[model samples]
Target: MIILGVDPGLTRCGVGVIEAGAHRRLSFVHVDVVRSSPDMSQDLRLLAIYNGLAAKIDRFAPDTVSIERVFAQENRNTVLGTAQAAGMAMLAAAQRGIPVALHTPTESKLAITGNGHALKPQMERMVARILGLNEPPTPADAADALAIAICHALRPAGALQGGEREQHLTPAQRQWAQAAQRSSGRGRRNADRGM
Candidate 1:
């Protein structure tokens, strides 16, 4: 399975694509950071994110998308942009009839590093080790994206057997599932329109 993972942010959204084999081993396909200038208007910035993610989706043709769930932060503005970028990711996946999974920060960290509170350096190290990269991916965000993908790829079977009926999902994950359903039709329509 090919999985695309996104660490969404208006200024520096991170994207990573990985392919998993029958033996559960993973290989890196691509890693990138999509940047939008702070000086750009909100709509323009969001457009950049949407277009960039859409292109990645088309290029990678991932089987599924794994995205980091947005959490409340002290900075409301930051949180809002992150949520918006995340929405763009979902839209890109849904447009292609791809399923989306949302993983919490702690969940991703634990999946990769065996520690919920692992630091950035530790997480990066594990990501490199798991992918057998000579060095960790740069800019932290990229590494985080890769980690999110690995988390979903390595998730226990019990969690994914029920489709969207999986239990213990966070509110953000449930919301993503619903949006993906709604967007599935929209995706076809958009494709018809050459969007």
Candidate 2:
């Protein structure tokens, strides 16, 4: 399976493509940082990101697109730009009917380095080791994209098929499922209390 992972940003969106083989093996196919000038108009910058991702989607014909889920931060502008780029990535995959999977940074880090709070250098090193590269992929964004893809690649087959077989889930999936359950449980509790 060919998977395209996107680390979205308006100024430097990182994209990584990998081919997943039998038995959880993964091979790197491509890595790039799509850049848009900060001086460019907002709409134009967005268009450039969209076009860049679309071209790659066309070139790779990825089976699935893995993208970093947008999270809130102190800088609202950064968050907005990131969310926009993420939307472009989703749009590019949607145009080709390719499924898109959103993975949180914590999830990716945990899957890649076995630590949800891993630092950037650690993630880069792990990603390099996993792909059998001589060195880590340059510019943190590129490595981050690859890590996201690896995280998705590591998921158990049953998880990919929409099965909730806890025993078949990887650590990342188990954590995500537990988090989801906790959030839903809170909602159920609130409903019970007539909130």
TM-scores, all models, native as reference: 0.81, 0.80
Clash counts for all predictions: 0, 0
Model 2, residue pairs in steric clash: none
Relative to the true structure, candidate 1 has a C-alpha RMSD (angstroms) of 8.4
lDDT of candidate model 2 versus the reference: 0.81
Model 2, residue 140: what's the lDDT? 63
List the lowest-lDDT window of 10 residues for candidate 1: 186-195
Candidate 1 lDDT over residue span 6-68, tens digit each: 999999999998999988899888999998999999999999999999999999998879988
lDDT string, candidate 2, 1-195, tens digits: 998999989999999988989987888899999989999999999999999999999999988898887866526768888888999998888777677787778888888888899999989988988888889987766988888889888864543422223324666886786677677664223222210
RMSD of each: 8.4, 7.2
Error of 1 at 121 (Å): 0.6
Q: Which regions in candidate 1 have their CA more than 4 angstroms from the true location?
A: 160-195
Candidate 2 error regions (>4 Å)? 156-195
- Highest-scoring model, TM-score: 1
